[model samples]
Target: MSDRDPQPVERQLPTEEARDLLALVRDIAQREIAPKAAEEEDAGRFPREIFTLLSEAGLLGLPYDSEYGGGDQPYEVYLQVLEELAAARLTVGLGVSVHTLASYALATYGTKQQQVEHLPAMLGGGLLGAYCLSEPSSGSDAASLRTKAVRDAEGSWVIDGTKAWITHGGIADFYTVMARTGEDGPRGITAFLVPGDAPGLSGAAPEKKMGMKGSPTAQVHFDGVRVPDDRRIGEEGQGFSIALAALDSGRLGIAACAIGLAQAALDEAVRYATQRRQFGRAIADFQGLRFMLADMATQIEAGRALYLAAARLRDAGRPFAKQAAMAKLHCTDAAMKVTTDAVQILGGYGYTADFPAERYMREAKVLQIVEGTNQIQRMVIARHLAGPEGR
Candidate 1:
């Protein structure tokens, strides 16, 4: 709403094409996304049309293989693009991340025949996806999921159970689901690619969330939902491993998003303090407020560097699970602090919805709890440092 242009991000891209990709992302974000973000968020309206535009622009699957219609960009470049989108609007950025996560199983584990048959439609054909992992009783303990998929005599699978906190639950064109196929425990789980319109599958009403209402989060039910054997991804009893692998990369996506949210809050605070005067002088002239702004900006930069480092490790085919957890923990915590400080910076106006500070504050809270909680991230780091649990 300010007449000024969106703040520019200084980036170090390896190639000229990557720089151009970032530029196009910023242009679409400012012109198409940021302009409608505040209004649509307030109205709790999901912008399906904007997603269609992103698909056409080849922005939906940047990190996947271009042989299957993906952009074939590295995780390092793809994550920066996520940060730009998150800066403009959390819902759009996070939604894109979830879609990419949902596509992971098929893209990575599917056979050549399966990839050729499905990847094109999923990555570039304007189809949205949802990931179904967490169940009603399973939160941080995801491997203990109770959803069962039984193989029938005709080589068809029948799924029965509930999947909770699914993003894009009702609107997605496909769902990458994890279900129990054998005995209890992580090794017993299996992955499946289920069409959205599968028989006996339905979504409950979206949760009345405190923020990010524009991105629907709901419970999905499968009552004898049937699919052919060919729809399964990876081997039997391999779902839990696939889920964790996806989250390793997905955590970096979340870390980038958190940094982006913090950057937006910092930009707002800096803009407000420099323009608004107190006692015939700008509030930015005060030492206390100036130091506060400095600290906020520093946190954003540090978090950005942390996530990017993790992303680079992933790109290099190195072991980065611990680093990914560290990035997720540090970045989300920083976002919570920075956005809260931005609200404090504005004092009265920040509490009301008149400015974006309050919305950013609300949106940042969920980042701490999503992908994996900060507590879970800490556990992951400690396990890597010491040894596996009970070792």
Candidate 2:
């Protein structure tokens, strides 16, 4: 509400416990993750060992209830951990975000039996998860998704269709799939938990993506894949709502990734400016370049504030869909701008893989596209403001 401090701020300064957690994560990130990121990404490799390290450190399940073997940490804490991970490597950050999104359906909608059966593996770190909501024909328009699941005489659900652009597609141990079960609308959709080894369930070869190369992306094909009715999440008509609700939280995760990427870019820029001298002085000493760094830092701080505010709202059980969408849109845009500027600050070296900024720039592009494009985020926010029946 004051000039120096903004209203609706999201993050609390790192608490003692949070600071300890951050230190632990940072140590692992810089020492363990940073060295391998570039090589793994270049080879399109997924780091199974790194995930094991994170799980052993109690990081894989940071935000869920503790009874399920999670850290039971706050989003505020969880997101900062994510930021550090991403600063080290975007692929890991994105994979964690996707896993968290996949967890939402089971945590929020599944029965107690289901939770007990699934959460331990997910929280304990043996199994990875994939979220299957988007299809070849439907990305932003989720309600128009074509995948279908029909009930059989044996009281099982038979699913047949392809899910496109699935993160962890071929690599995941399980998938959270949404399929149409009723009339042609979101209300007709239902969610199911499908194990990776299920018969007739398979994935296409991974997509050759522009960035986040270490993170596998592919199309999942469910050809008459069957599951018991108990596998369905929530009631028959609740999948769309569940997916959107999960996305409200997922958007914040992406926002954290953006902040981490931007911070990495800024750090590289600052380091480069100091080391790469111009006119017989460190370039950072130049007021023009200094101002640009100031702007980049300011934007990143603002993005952090926005996403954290929305996260606090969600944790407090308040209406946060609009705020989450706004955070996703603004923070991702700011990250894209900041990372690009980071490259510019590094001048020629920024364009090469020798430094991390070039990769950060490429990684930022996907943040804009995934978890609902910034364009779709704008529409979500606009709809929230304009009311259910818009003018």
Candidate 3:
């Protein structure tokens, strides 16, 4: 790590409380998260305790209602918090984003009784969550997921099939799952909140991923996993719509994370460039390197503005899906570009794990692929523009 402390980002928070919240997040991130990030991630160790600490600090539920232990903050504030956490460590930041995504179905669609029963523990009671949507056979084509949830004579549901690429997988306290309940396509699906310890539910080994290895990505299997009817998150056959809505918001979370990762890479590059001298002068003094840094910073700033604009739209209850898709597309692509540029700036050292540029590069690649692939984001944008492609 560079000896120089990274400068704090200047934020335009809406209120004194939000400003204080960001300060607290930076403190926790620096003192607690940043210190061990490189070591733990290198060891492929998941920091479960850090998430518990975040829960204790009320950072886990910022965008939810306070009535059920949430912080009641808007998406703008919540996503900024995500950006700070991600800048400290991608695992923590992305883990928090995935946890929030997992909570969305129930928080937004469940009955008041369901919310009262589950939201408190989920939001601030130290419990973690996973979202179950993608199956081995269905990733980008999620509407074709084969997982089935059959209603028994007792009205309880029996879920069967497997979910692939689950972020928190085996370790989550609960899973917000989508499974087929009616027809063969999107409309046939239903959502359920299954307890982590639900009978017959199990997780396969975590995938050996290229990056974000510390955050487990595993396949979750349901072998007739039973859940009470009350756990159903929305009206029957509404799961696809719920999942899409959650993705629209979730994509913004990813955009924030991508920018955070890019920012970290930029900070690392600047530190290296100024410290490493060539021909009796710092390479950063070279006009070529200076311009590279300038472009990287500009991209990062543009990505940040794009995601924040989408976030504000969400907070205003306006149509923001297209904007969210655009942000996800641009920000992740920018992260990939910026981090790769950082590695280029660092040259040989950047290619090695001795510095974080390589790690940032590796982590940034996944952002382009997660939440929704850049290709999918483009399709979503195009659909919004010219209408969906007809078969």
Candidate 4:
């Protein structure tokens, strides 16, 4: 099984350029990312150099405008790239997704001057970014965050709070931070582009996690970290809106990554089944195992379709938040189920670190909880369906 390559996905790309882009991505994934994934992940080592390679290749900012160092690809193409990267390694794929999320507020809401000043360096200049919204006390209830950003006499904002579950945390070059600047609820929140090395900014130790340890998840502290007015991405009290918009796009990235991870697991399971002999026959000859593989593949395909549909809606500049939530929920759930089945198919070998199946299973679990928990996704979908819940 180790000697054979996994089959490439048959993608329906809109343009020849996109096909070329996918080919480039596949080559890089096969040559650079996939080979080192399991070992680096097992060692809990972040592949900062691979991200530099991606930045150089213009993969980091594919969905944003090309004028300011972005690739200008639509979400459809951008997400497929993410899926390919994720199939190679969740750490790299999810890192790219979080970086994109961190860049969204500035690209979408910042002034032309801001974009001209920072976007180029962020997008393709070997810089990494982190998104800061989830707080230690408020994960699901992000609107109820206690982080405070106060305007001082110097006209600079002094931020004071701790943001939890930040993907890049201490390692990021910049942070897109959402802090309370006014009232007690969502209305008071404001977004700021804070430099990672700003005075009083620090990160606690990375969380020891069930999976994806190679991607640092840490608590970022803002102890009176100050930023100039120019660093504010959008209007005060408009931060939550920016956050929601970014999350809608970010959820699609997660959905794509989930499908990619599922696809990888399915490929591994198939490869093992075809090679491993049992009862004087290959395991692939067993109907039960074949059915499991079929089910896993179907779910992955469905998830890919769902995420791409959401991406297309986004590319058309249409309303897609509900669809985004749905894709995230379904794809992540599919990832968990598919990874678990892959582990089951591998039998005892899947339970140990000797195989990638266990790692895939561990990684799939966190997807259901991030971006927004699956519970929050259901609520978001329900709100779109039944209107806002009676409070």
Candidate 5:
């Protein structure tokens, strides 16, 4: 048999360039992210400067086209980079994922003219973006969102409504907004790219979240927010399809970030268990603790494989929606379990803020909820396997 890479987490990278890229990301994660992650997270500080730094490093636009100032890396490379950043800090990892999601409409569906006008600044030019989908009245039932966008005789559209649970809400430079533009259903909606400084757009105070406090989530209000006809993405009444397509890719991003968080927690647990002693021996030396550690590692590895499998399907341009849902469901659930076990391995110390384990545990909980809840993922998978429920 041919010799294979001996590493357990051995990646089947596509090229030397991808390997170099991974190294660059790891360097940034260690030197810039990890050193301040725990402290800044405790302070609830949003690292805007770090994001700018990442933009400067050309880290934000990987997986998009090089023709439009993006790095043109594939989904596999882009996601592995996300994993590295997440291993350093979940906030940064998830922030990058959200940014990519926010840009998807313009990148994938916007006209050539539209891409030329806005894609560069939004992708890698130090500007941030937010996606507007969830509203106060509709989340799981998102097609029922009531945010309205009405067009005047001059063809200018005016939007009015509140979008809820927006990540990077107050600080985003632009927003990809979906609003109802026609009848009373999914087909009535349309998407628009709205500038952050628009006269009638505003953000409410950030929510008091249980975790990822450094990443703000808030309500954004649009009161007659007007935009030129040129700002619409895709055709009117196609917004729901665009949003669903974006989420299909976005769910995989969350899965990768979840695995990153789980890996970090597992590393912390192993470190603590090996260093801390119990009954005149290291706790890690005991069979029970060893089994727990083994289980955690196995779960993380399995989750990583699941997300990568989904990512590969996406890169190959196959139908990966169902796989994306599976990865998101499996990975986030595994993250919740592994992180909890990690805290258990560290005992009291893990429960304290002094160690990052407790914080990791808290952060892992949100993964199960965002990008669609686990329950929602289950429904998506079931719908794919079986037909939709009969009315």
Candidate 6:
């Protein structure tokens, strides 16, 4: 049997680059975000000010090229920044992740002119973005999306559909939308850049969610909204591929968020264990509880390793869909398990809104559901193993 590389939590090579960014992100999150995360979540307020702080800190474009106002940072560095933010506030981390997803099409597939027109604002100008690929009838099975786009005589197109579960919904400055432009199938879809103020485009009231309440989530409706053909991200019938490619990269972001959330939960549990007294001793001294802590820490390390591996594959221009699926699956599941266990360690305190554990537990559930569900991730990995002939 071939030997496989062993994974470790803290890097042995000592990546100064990743460390520096992580330190900065941690500072910002602690100073500006951590204090308010709980309040915003409780009040159902959007942290747009925090978003501006991130953009101004040159963090909004961490994984993109510097030519377009981006940081030109590596995925390794970018992901850790996301992790730090998630540890502070899941809402902000998830909002950043979703914005990165919405911006992928322009960065990866748009014409040079298109990128020049939009990339700067998206990267460093505090402009939020939303990705619109899912419809009421076509969430998991996106190829069956019914949104239609028809080209007009004036070289414009009229798009009509309702996109569901759009993060940043009414708050975003622009949307990267996928609509059917041909016959029914994945190949029939096309991608477009629609401004938030475009005619006939509107968002519904934000969805009542289980957690991550500070980040807005709602349905966006396009009723005869028009855009110039020049706004298209790629050739007609290429939206499905673009959307899938975005997800391949976007999954890494979700994985990072999940790992961060898990790390926070683990930290809280460990701190609580050490402080809370038992029978004349700290609960952490108990062997059974210590083993639980060990398991939580181990799972967190595994989640981080999985996402970093996927990120390396992505940066190297390798086929990363399988790895991305694996990262998302493992990390989100780990987040759920770790957060739930944290609540158990916290005992009755974890169940109350006064603490963050219960909130983090609820937030972790959505991570498993989004970026393609954990079930979808399994299907993606299985397809890789089966190969084309297996189809």
TM of each candidate vs. truth = 0.98, 0.95, 0.99, 0.99, 0.97, 0.95
Worst 10 residues of 2 by lDDT: 1-10
lDDT per residue as tens, model 5, 10-125: 66589999998898888998899999998998888999998999999888889898778789899998998898899899999999999999999999999999998898898789
| Candidate 6 ranges beyond 4 A from true positions | 1-17, 388-390
Q: What C-alpha lDDT, on a 0 to 100 scale, does residue 245 get in candidate 4?
A: 96
TM-score of 2: 0.95
> What tens digits encode model 3's per-residue C-alpha lDDT throughout 188-239?
9999999999999999999998899899999999999999999999999999
Roughly what TM-score does model 3 have, to 2 decimal places?
A: 0.99
lDDT of each: 0.94, 0.87, 0.95, 0.96, 0.91, 0.89
Q: List the candidates ranked by lDDT, beginning with the highest.
A: 4, 3, 1, 5, 6, 2
Tens digits of per-residue lDDT for model 1, 233-284 = 9999999999999999999999999999999999999888887889999888
Model 2, residue 241: C-alpha shift (Å) = 0.4
RMSD in angstroms, candidate 3?
A: 0.9
Whole-model lDDT for model 3 versus the true structure? 0.95
lDDT of 2: 0.87
Q: Which residue pairs come into collision in candidate 2? A: 10-308, 10-309
Residue 91 in candidate 6 has what lDDT? 92
Residue pairs with backbone overlap in model 3:
none
lDDT of 6 by residue, 1-391 (tens): 0132222136422377667777778789989999988998999999899889999988888888789988888787788788888989999998899988999999989999999999999999889899999888888998999989999999899999899999998778999999999988999999999999998999999999999888889999999999999899999999999999999989999999999999988888877888888899988899999999999999999889888888888778788899999999999999999999999998999999878899999999999999799999999998898865445
Q: Which is better, 1 or 2, measured by lDDT?
A: 1
Report how far off residue 216 is in candidate 5 (Å).
Answer: 0.6
RMSD of 2: 4.7
Question: RMSDs, each prediction?
Answer: 1.1, 4.7, 0.9, 0.8, 3.8, 5.1
